[model samples]
Target chain A: MKRVGIKDVAREAGVSPTTVSLVLNGQSARIPDTTRDRVRRVATEIGYAPNSVARSLRTQRTHTIALISDRIATTPFAVEMVQAAQDVAREHGYLLLLVNTDGDHDVEREAVDALLSRQVDGMVYACMWSQVVDVPAGLPAGTVFLDGRPAGGGFPAVMPDDRAGAMAAVQELVDQGHTRIAYIDAGEEPVPIASRLRHEGYLEVLRRAGIEPDPSLRVEASITTAAGGVAAAGELLDRPPAQRPTAIFCFNDRVAMGAYRAARHRGLEIPTDLSVVGYDDQQFIAAELDPPLTTVALPHYEMGRWAMQVRLGVLAAPTENDGVHLMPCPLIRRESVAPPPAQHPAPAGDGE
Target chain B: MKRVGIKDVAREAGVSPTTVSLVLNGQSARIPDTTRDRVRRVATEIGYAPNSVARSLRTQRTHTIALISDRIATTPFAVEMVQAAQDVAREHGYLLLLVNTDGDHDVEREAVDALLSRQVDGMVYACMWSQVVDVPAGLPAGTVFLDGRPAGGGFPAVMPDDRAGAMAAVQELVDQGHTRIAYIDAGEEPVPIASRLRHEGYLEVLRRAGIEPDPSLRVEASITTAAGGVAAAGELLDRPPAQRPTAIFCFNDRVAMGAYRAARHRGLEIPTDLSVVGYDDQQFIAAELDPPLTTVALPHYEMGRWAMQVRLGVLAAPTENDGVHLMPCPLIRRESVAPPPAQHPAPAGDGE
Candidate 1:
């Protein structure tokens, strides 16, 4: 099929090509609405796509943005950030050029170079997980970081409020009247910044509740997976009946799942014999567990939108100290939390 | 900092702007290696980036490929297709323009129009799961379909071999000496094409093995979630001991997880009392299941790479009937499959 152009739409509408262009581009203030509607209808009928390449050269702005990510494309739920960024870019008449560099420096450099060559108006540097990363050299000004912070922070960064999220998770258990709560920590060495912050929040909540934080109540998982949760929860549940924790707070939903398995293996019922709380309300795992998990949701979608807004100059970068935007993490309550069993003593006329 | 230009590199390298452009563009065959090396080194040192916008205006080729996906960005594992396509496009000196429409037709139309205006060299219409869809009108030739086939069937398509993958999953069970197999099907009416194909594969394998397919053993889940699997698998497992299925094949990993819970509720041990298999070897769920699941992997990465190759003309589109490229789905063996318990004779000193 012949490629439709402004000339084709003009010929079909019986108007000059310049008139067609003006009407279609919304630059025809002097033209009647009837003529503008006719030109647009004719253009749509004939599929007359505007040549952005030619327009880009004349205007010197391609109306394109580059979203360079460190493996966000391959992860679950986190990709919502990419989707939000894309939606914002599209709303502003810009297309997104996406590049996933798999955290390889060489690939990132090449991707940056390619995006620069394409003359994208701005860029968003996103990470799969919240962390402190070294921003690559040669990134043009106006690059916004999402779910991460620059190591020597000056650029605008949007990340989840890990400490607040942790506090919320622990507070949920506290609200349920559980005093002896055990924590399964994601304890890889050089503990991740999130792990540290969440740990601090857990400690704060316990202290604020007037509960003495027991040293034996805290157990570290080798990793942050469900398997890790199982191993760590096993340790806490292995204690004598009097010392066993009534509730367990996990690092993330994956560990929470492991904890579920551990409880089941020991014939403990959730929200009955034991209560559990988790973090990172990851899709599928959080709401889909046997008894849906109560977790803290990372505001990935909000962070994504915020990052794009900063990059597009729709939202100004925070000028405060550290220049990081902390998006709130809300606690999602489900069926996994309840009062301690001791609070629900059996009636006097029961089995005995 | 002011953007460095070709002239800056030319001046520093002691060469004309045209010579520098030629060297950077890799059209410097006649130029001496020493001159080429100097020009490249100076370009790198001064950070002279090539202007693709102007070059595209002159060449009429934008060197950009648009990947339009239907909710792929939000799903797990399937985004690997996007990554694979990006890698291939990058290797060929092109950038990927990604747009996810979340299966909204209006959004899809707008996205298609925007990409068409941007003058992308090619496009890839990707679906999150394998199915037949109507190709949107006005897309240029050379557009490739990934993980889906065009309803009218005239375009190049790359999709997983669902039927073959199903056969493989069942064959693994047969190899383990299972005959009393049940299927936990994704039972929504007008079943998804993948479910239909996989179900056919299961029936074909049973018939080929001389085992009559039992209608009661083929239970359907209302949805393809882990919860659905539990409901459907519960019905199949609720039978008397003599009538119980020796194994179950789940529609997907989510359902398999449900089956796991169902079996556990019935005091059945996986691979000891019953064996199970699942499809879509989703990350975190499949491999991370307590006893790692044995499942089939949808060749998303391969289909992605293949689609890109077809888009880039690196590989020729199939000339045969249908023009759909069937990428093989590989069965990933874990600990989920085992010989039927009946196949093992009781030892002399057994519990009985």
Candidate 2:
């Protein structure tokens, strides 16, 4: 079948092609609403589709974005962020071309080169985990970061407020009348710095409760994996029964999963014996756990929207700003965390 | 710095621009090997990148593939299939544009229209599960199906060999001497025909071993989720002792996880107490379990490669073939299954 054109819609609607184009483009402010409606109805009847490639060539705008990531396309839950970005881009008549770099600098360079060749109008960089890394030098004019910021500086980054998320989680435990909460950090070589931010949040909350943060109560996780969470809990569990912290805050959900394993290994029941709180609120891990996981959730979908907006703005106006936008990390309450044991006094802590 | 162009590469290499172009495009067969190497080296050294968009317009080939997925991008391990496709596409100088439809016909139509407008050369439609779904009508001619087949066939499709995978798993159980093996199917409302295929493989293997498949031992999982798995195992475990099957073959990994939970709830240890086998080989669920899991792994990475090859093949030569290719699903032996109890006799039945 011959492809339908705007001319067909115009001829059928008894209108000029210019009027048909204006109506189809939603730029029918001068045209009467009735005319616009009729033109649209006729276009649908005739299957009129504006030749997008032809339009792109004329306008010098591909309306396509390149989302280059280490593994966002493969990582669990992280892909949701990409999907959210796709949804936003689609709303704005743009499609996303994702290039998985696999953390190889050479692969990243090739991916960028390939996307540039395809004429992607803008670019977004995503990392599975929030981390501080050097922005690729000489990026296209319109580039944005997701879940990370340039260790050095370049574009606007939308990262989860890990400090706020950790504070909210610890505060949840505090509200349940538990004062002695343990902080499980992402160890010494914390890549993202969220581990330190979250640790600081925990300390600040303890100080707010008028309990001096105990150095001994603070422990570092080996890595952000489940094994790390398990090891971090092992140290705290080693302490005498009454002396151990009543509750623990993990750096991420995987760490919390590790804590669950450690607790189960040591015959410790969750919530009943120990109140646990985690971050990242990874649905697959959080929802599938035994009692479910009460954790802090990052606004990945919103973050995606914000990143797309940043790229869109940069494309519209070539402006540069060294901005770090920390999106809110909301607290998701489930069954994992609860009040510490009844016999333990309110604000239980070491005899300082 | 100003962008380097073909003219610059020719000048830098002391060769004609035609020679540089030919070398860059791999049309350097007529050129001397040493001259070709020098031109390529000069191109890389001077950072000469061909104007891809202009070239695409000239060649009428975008060298871009659209990966339209229902939920593969949002799924856990299934996203790896996309990554595999991306890796293969990248090697062949193609970038992938991923659009998630979530099984909505409207969204699928929009995604296809948008991609067609962007001049994507081909498309691969992927679904998280292997099911027979209605192929969206009027899809671009260069399209292939992944993990699913068109209800009414036209294009090429690649699906997991679930029957072969199931037979292999059951045979492993049988080799270790299991006759009364239970089949926890995906139920009669199975969206993916793989469930039934796997169940059939199990029965066929049992019959081959001269064992009549027990009707009571066969149960169907309500859903493929972990909860569905747990429920399916619950019904099987409800039977009186000595009547229960010596081993169980779950529909998928999540179902196997459920069987693990049910076994634990009933004080039965995996392999030692009741040998359990699962399908899908989901890393998170399979690896993290107490004893790990022995399961059949769908060759998702291979399936992706197959889908990409099909699309590329169609683009190379517009040939028509109503083909459904079933890729191998290899067995990944972990710790979930083992020899049946020594006390049990050969061909152990309900009479035991």
Candidate 3:
């Protein structure tokens, strides 16, 4: 069978090939509605598949955006961001091309060159975790960053408001009438921006509540995983009844899971005996805990949507001085928080 | 400055535009190496970016493939498959375009039409979970399925060997001196192929060991999540000490997590009082458990690579008669498995 081309559609529709092209390429606003309909109907009747590749060469608009990320598609973290970007892009008749670099610079360069070779209209550079990243060279002029900011601070970035999220988490604990609060900070030297901002939020809340931050109550987890949570929370939980914190704020949901285990090991019932709050509201881990978990949501989906909008010009592009968009991180209330216990129990045997 | 084109490179290299196009498009095999290197050097020196869209229109080879998946890119499950497919495609000098349909049929049709319009050389149709899916209409011929088989059974498919994976999980328990074992199956009504195959593996292993399959031991989880596992495993663990199984083979990692909690509530330490094995070594949930879970890994990454290889003709395409490729699922040994206890303790208070 012979493939139908634009010339065939033009001959059948009794119009110039350029006219047929304009009607099919969605640039037919000036063309009468009847002519547009006739061209489309004839093309459909003759089985003519409009070739975007050919149209793109003439118009310099492929209507395709490339999303290059370090590990968003492969890792379990922040997958919603990709979905949200795809959703917005689809609505605008633009296809999204995904490329995961696996955190390799060479792979990233290759991916950028490939997208540029195809003349993608725009690019979305995303990161799995919220951090400052060095924007690779050769990216197009209007590249938008998701969940991260450029180290040189020129590109537009959409990131979760970590400090505000932390304040919300701690405020919930304070609202529950808990004064003795402990914080399990994550990461070591050169801590991530999220960790630093979250810690600052925690202290700000304590200060506003007229409560002095206790040195012993502030502990650092070796990492942000559940294992780290257990060790950090265990130290605070092992303290005498009078000295132990009544509530704990963890770095992330994984660490909160550790707090759950630590509390379980010490025979402490959540909320009743101790209250806990976590950050990043990670899927499965947060909602699947025994008492469920009260935590801060990272706004990944919203960030994705915002970045796509910026890239596509649906939203105004951020200026050079105001390029970073700090999306709000809302508090998700679950069953993990309540008023402090009436009285504390005596110290129990230390359990690993 | 004006944009550089093939004409500029041709003029600079003292060659015709045809020669410039042939060399830059990787079709310089018939040309002398000296001319080919000279053309490429001139093209690079002048910063002439090859317009692939224009080249594709003339040659009908876009060097691009589309991966249209039902939730694979958005969801955490089977994400490695996308990564693997991208890696293989990138190695072959092909860019992979990703479109997630979000399980909507209309959305899928639009995605397919969009890809076809763009003239992708081929497509990989992927599903987040292994199952028989109805191939959406309008997908071009030679489309390959990953982690799923077409319901009509014509397209080539790459899927995990769920039956063999279950066998490995159960065989491990049998080798570890566990006589009495229980299974927590998932999903109801239209049970997924994985559930049925895994059950068969369990029964087959038990029969070969000459152990009678206990009807009470084979229970069903209302859902595959941790909450469902708690309810299902709680029922089994609530049985009399003499009647309880020493090991529990959960449907997946989430269910295994529930079994852990159920055992803790019953004062049964993992592996010491009860042994547990899970399937789908899901990221975070499997490795981040209290004692890392022993589970079977779904061959998602391998399946992705295989499907891409078939699509790109790197491997022999599956014939209609042998279109389904079953990749093996290997057992990841962790701390969750051990020998059964020496003696059963007397029935203690029933714990939820």
Candidate 4:
């Protein structure tokens, strides 16, 4: 029993192999519907099945994209980048391949080799945490960076607007009529590159508001955890009531939680006692916390969608403007912000 | 200019195409070292760059696996499943393709068709939340389900051991001398299928301990959120002090947080007033919850790695395993659970 070939179908349908190929591949718009129907019926009657491998070789298009990342699956919320990119790729009739390199350069090289060997049309390089990354060798056209900027400056990058986000968060606090705002930062290393951008934004907004910079108000967290927030907040609040800032801007949501804990420890109620704002609206932390949290939203999903679009655009026609593309980080207002108290008071309520 | 082909290199090196191919592909074990070195030198002199697509065609292996998931990116914490699987796939020299269908049957169908057409070697079908799923049509050889069970038999699956986890949690509570233990459950929808299994485990443990189950001690909350924990806990503690259960097991960590809030609202301290245990370690939630939560680790990462291994195994040689593969769910001991209080007292302390 021999597999029926396309030529056999063409002969049976009284048409050329190209006509049969067009009809079978679903690219038969130019061909007549009646002829296509006849060709399809003939192919079905002859049991003709197109070979996938042969088709790929002939078409030179796999309709696939590789998503190279440093451990997206392990990161809790950052999976949104992959999810959104996959959705966009599916819409464009492309499959999104995920390669988690585990921060091992060798594994990443193997992944790129495998994907390239399979002839993926494009790729989107993403990072679990936003940072500056070294561009991989053999990066073809249509490759875009998501959440990480390329250090070499050839690849286009799509990232969170961290500076603008911090500025907006501080501006929101100021709009609520609070002036004395302190900045809690993750000390160094391991902290995302966007953290520095956010710190810059915090200072820029503070200067614009004419609040003189106070080095005493800025506390660096050694471990970059909620414990850091607690210690930093404690440092600021332990000072004389008159000298203390009315509000605090945390680098991220986890630090904000620490600040919340610190405020509670000092018998200060959120908003009513200390207006608090956080970044990266991590849903579990922000919504689940008591009184909820007002924070900055990282546009992870949208950035993914935009990155895919940019990749597709590069595939269509190469463009210049290798500059960074910054997506907005919107402010998510909850119940955590309020005007500063007239005077810090002694505990009116007992332990909560 | 004509591309430098393997045949050209072979001609220049005075060797057959097979000898040249073996040397260039790093498979020169059978050939002499001198011959290998000569072929390599000639290939390099000619600037021979192997065409990846042609190599794939000759090899007949894509070294790719597809992960068909139901909204993994949207669901928080479940990304660990992807991360672990991706790492495993990378270890095996396979690129993992992600297809997030968002529960759309059409998109899922398209994903299957596209992956099949692109000749992916295997697939790992996963769900963001654990549940029973219908096997997709036209599932080829070398496929496994992750964090979900195929409704029909004849497929391998890897999932968290929910029953054993619950039993272990209950056993831990019993070991600490708490008899009047209660169970709080999420009402109906969105309550993971594992919840029912956990409930069964709880009952099994209680029966083993010679403790008769109390129906009134079981309170089903409306939503699966922290608010649900609060309401259910409030219902349990609203009764007379003599009749109240000493220990309560909330369905999940979020609910446990609610229970924490409820205990605080009632001026009851965790462990001293109420011993709380949660499920799904949910690092962000469980670890950050002030006293932290003593909960069950869902084994999401392990489950993912196991699923990928199963997929690779299937690709190697398919095996039949109709039964569910229940991975261990370890207990993470935190400060949340403690021995039942000696006596239930009325509100005494103002706060902490």
Candidate 5:
């Protein structure tokens, strides 16, 4: 059967094409009620799909995609992710519409509704460090999840391979001839899948190396801000020098920055005094620090591009669906980490 | 005349209230031709207004406002402005939708169109820095400009008192007992009204003090990034140590940070070796730097809140409207500036 067009609906309803266009586009506020009803009824009966793509061809798409994050402006990683996302979006004839929801469910609901109302061809829902938030029912058709896994089913999502990324960070610290390594976890619990996976990866690496994970060496903070990282660092540094871990692995760049500041405040030099490793290599933070940070680079730009493509309905659901796309998180070796301090003698624990 | 309700329209059209709603809301894709036409004609004959506010009362207004910036992720001042805007928007039960246009006119057009399509109750158009960009014609009613004066001038706008702000920076430097103070202006030329006012402010203070405004001391950089500031610093520093200005006043915070980096790289101590003042006191950059920066603070949050309230029709337009709301820019004193080094004697320059 031939596809129905606006002309056909207009002819059937005995309304002008302009009337149909106005009513169909939801600009019916300016139109008289009688005409709007007639046009809509005829369009519906004739099975008109509104042909948004066809409409877009005539009027160039704003070449912009909406990026809705829980609270992006304050989070450094989120800010960088948005920047990378905008870069990628611009490369593909699109701009980024970034909305900060402040993690309010009502706000999130309103944001989604507003984006839909704007007729965003696609959407990128980037949560700030994932937590299980209910995806509102009845979202605009083409939407993708970013930095988060779809909660109740399959949806196109882009997130780091947290398990592998965490393992790599831990493995690198182990390889640098450091046995006593501590983990500074910055996030609330029943941690996000990404966070949990990373934590598990750290444990897996420790287990494989025949080293027991010590509870005392693991520190958890509520927020992933630099201040939280500083607090975590304080907790780690309060232990006796001999009992302190030789190296530290931070949750992300911000936490690592905090750790750097904390170490300095305590009069300890980096690398020589205490080695540090961070994740999410944010350029500004990394470049500005006294000794540049060593970190794991999550493919933020690539993920953003892929998220848009997925929302545009270009990708089919993964056949071997694990419900997660685990992208590689590569390590960036910088001056922050080095061989453990030579002066301190090994603790009096059995080699076995 | 009584306000015509959906029921009244339905009664006139001899159709169900749902049918009138489908037509009025433009959900016409599901209705039939004959009935749609009859319903529309009857509704129009009765002159029905949908009363969006009443609809919102039944279903809460999205309560989301879009705070759109040309590009913010890379511009530190823009980022601070967005954060402030978000804070105020949230306080007003409104979420901020941030769009990065990358300073592209086409992108700005598209972003505005998208925001309008979303049915945002109000909008805040914030450009990164100030420039002469045409506001798209026929903006959906209820939009306000921020940090920029509208080109064709219909909307309410909020911008800093650039002349006053600039004068404050220069006056502060002068009062610290430095006759050889220089200015590094970074922005587009013909200069934004804000920059022009600032330059005027600088000259105003200089002329009042009987100090000849040296053309050599005023340098304009392409953009206000740290790199731009560093290059400007290099130009100033290339002069003989005795010839260099005692103090430098930067166009914005990023440029100041760059100057700070350059001075530190050249083994000069802040204030003691060289005094500096910046604009738009960005929090993160200011707090993290070694000697926290002293700069002018733009009232970003108040401006944003006021901008939104104007667009929301909550505030009446001022009678003596200058098309711009000039907020006071206050000095935030920190560790970055002090009296010039006592070792070097003050330079005797040629009169203008």
Candidate 6:
């Protein structure tokens, strides 16, 4: 048996194929409702499938958006972001095509080209980490970056206020009587935007309190995994008991878990012996920890929604000098931190 | 600045636009390399961007695959499957366009229509759990389902051999002298294919050993979350101490965690008091559990790889009679189980 085509629907409905096409494509707003209904009913009865590719050719819009992330599958934040983006896209009758590049510039370039080839109306480029790089040339103008500063400028972005969030974490620690707090960063050299902002926030809070920063208390690790956090904790513990800080701030939750594990291994009671503060309230880490972690919550889902809105033209296009849209990160205080021991002495230089 | 057209490239390269189009589309097997190079260079220098929509119109190939999944962002296994599919697609110069339907039929229909409209070369349909659904009409022939048995047959699929894997778990328990094994299945009623198959395997193994199946020993719950598992375990433990089974088999790792919690709550020692075996060896549940769980490792990554290969036509299409591609679920023996206590007397009813 031969498949039914648009011509058969038009013939059955006593109309032209063009009329059937117009009605099926939802351009029937100007057409008579009776005629539209008749055509639609006939088409449905015959199972007349409209050719989408042909329709797309007639109208330049593909009703599709491309989301290019630098390895979104592995990152918790990226997962939330993608979910939010999908939610917004579905609401707007658009489909999201996600492409993960594994942070490779070449792959990024190829992905962009491929999305463009598919005629995606717009693009959202979300990097795993905010690192400076030259934007590849030849992309369509309707592109925006998510959680990163756009290279070569002009593109809009949505990012968390890392500095303010970090400042809040430290300020809370200070309010709780922590004078010699150590910032254990689980990120490599030439830190990414979030890391640098967080580090700066740590310093600013200390400066405001008139407390001189201790260089010995600052630590860095290669990655933000729990193992990296463990290594950093090991280094801190290796120092003389008199020199160790009362509390430690981790870069993220994974690092904090490692710190918790290391402290457990060393027979140090959490909060009672050494308070540990974490960033990014990842659920698995926070819920399963022996005593839940006190951490900063990054607005990943909101960022994703904003990213999609920006791409869909629902939000205003970013202008030059618009700077970053820094969403606030709130602190979720669980059972991880407490005041220092009464007998522990303050750092010697801070008293001066 | 005005956009450079294909005509401009043709003019610069002293060739027809059709010739230039053919060479740029990689249909240059018949054309000389020197001529192809000249056309490409001219196109690049003139900043001529090919109109991909027009190219697609001529070729009817999008070089894109639609990966329709039920909540790709939240389901860990689904995320890995999509990533593996993307990796495979990328190798073949195909882009993966993802759509998350959240298991809503309306959303699924919309996504299917949208992807179909985009003229995706093929489709990979992955669901969080298997259920019966009519295959949407008017789709291309290359669409395949993952983790779902094809409706009305003919579509290729990749799924675990739940029955065989379950039998292995049961056989292991039986070998350890667990005659009265409890099956705490924390899965919804009209159980998923995996659960049902595994249950069948469980029943088959017991019958073969000349043991009458006891319905009291089998309990079902709404889901496989740790909390659900805990609830199922609690119900099982409600039976008098004398009648409780010597061993327990959980639906998955999450459920197993709940079982561990339940056992701990009742002051029952793992393995010694109650031996437990789990399925789907999720990392956190296996590694972080107090005694570490003895669970079956599902080949998540390999399944992902196979799903991609099958969709891309790199692997042979499976037939309906082939049923599930049962991957081996080798038990990872941790400290979770041991032989039943020798002092405990067997329950009454031994008249043969």
Per-residue accuracy of model 5 over A1-352 as CA lDDT, tens digit each: 6557788888899988888998988988899998888888788787765443345434535345788877655554456567666666655656556677777887778767655544455777887665555676546544677777667755666677878888888898899888889988857744467667778988899999999888788888667767778888888987887678888999877788788878877888898888998888775566555577888887765666667666655555443554456568888888888888876566758588
lDDT of 4 by residue, B1-352 (tens): 8657899999998889999988887898898889989999998899777765576666767777888998876567788888888878877777778888887887777678767766678888998777888777767755788888888867778778889999999999999988988889879855478779889989999999999998888888788788888889988888898668888887888888888888888888888888989999886788888788899999988888888887887333234446568899999999988888877444777598
**Residue pair clashes in candidate 4:** A73-B83, A350-B351, A351-B351, A351-B352
Candidate 2's DockQ:
0.46
lDDT of 2: 0.81
State the lDDT of candidate 2 residue by residue for B125-235, as single tens digits. 998889888878659765788998888777778889888999999999999878779999886554558867898899889989898888899888888766777888888
**Candidate 2 docking: what grade?**
acceptable
Best lDDT goes to which candidate?
A: 3
- The residue-by-residue lDDT of candidate 3 on A300-321, one tens digit each, is 8899999999999999877755
- CAPRI tier of model 5: incorrect
On a 0 to 1 TM-score scale, where does candidate 4 land against the true structure?
0.91
In order, the Cα lDDT scores of the candidates are 0.88, 0.81, 0.89, 0.82, 0.73, 0.78
lDDT of 6 by residue, A1-352 (tens): 6556789999999999989888988999788999999998998899876666666767877888888887755664457788888899989988888787887888888788777666788888876655554565556776777777667676677788889999999988888888888888856644477788899999999999988999888898667777777888878866887788888888888778778867866878889988888888875556456577899998888888988998888988656456457778999898889987765465767854
Q: Candidate 1 residues B154-265, lDDT tens each?
A: 8999888889999999999988988889998888744388898899999999999999998888889998888899999999889986677999999999999999989989
The deviation in Å at residue A157 for candidate 6 is 1.9
DockQ of each: 0.69, 0.46, 0.64, 0.54, 0.18, 0.36
lDDT of 6 at A175: 82
Model 6 DockQ vs. reference: 0.36
What proportion of the real contacts between chains A and B does each prediction keep? 0.73, 0.52, 0.73, 0.69, 0.17, 0.47
In model 4, state the lDDT of residue B287: 88
What tens digits encode model 4's per-residue C-alpha lDDT throughout A35-102?
A: 99999898878766665666767677777788888776546678787878887887777778788777
Give the TM-score of chain A in candidate 5. 0.71
Better of 3 and 5 by TM-score: 3
Question: Where does candidate 4 stray beyond 4 Å?
Answer: A1-16, A25-33, A42-52, A314-322, A344-352, B1-4, B22-33, B44-52, B55-59, B314-321, B344-352
Off by over 4 Å in 3: A13-15, A22-38, A189-191, A344-352, B22-39, B189-191, B344-352
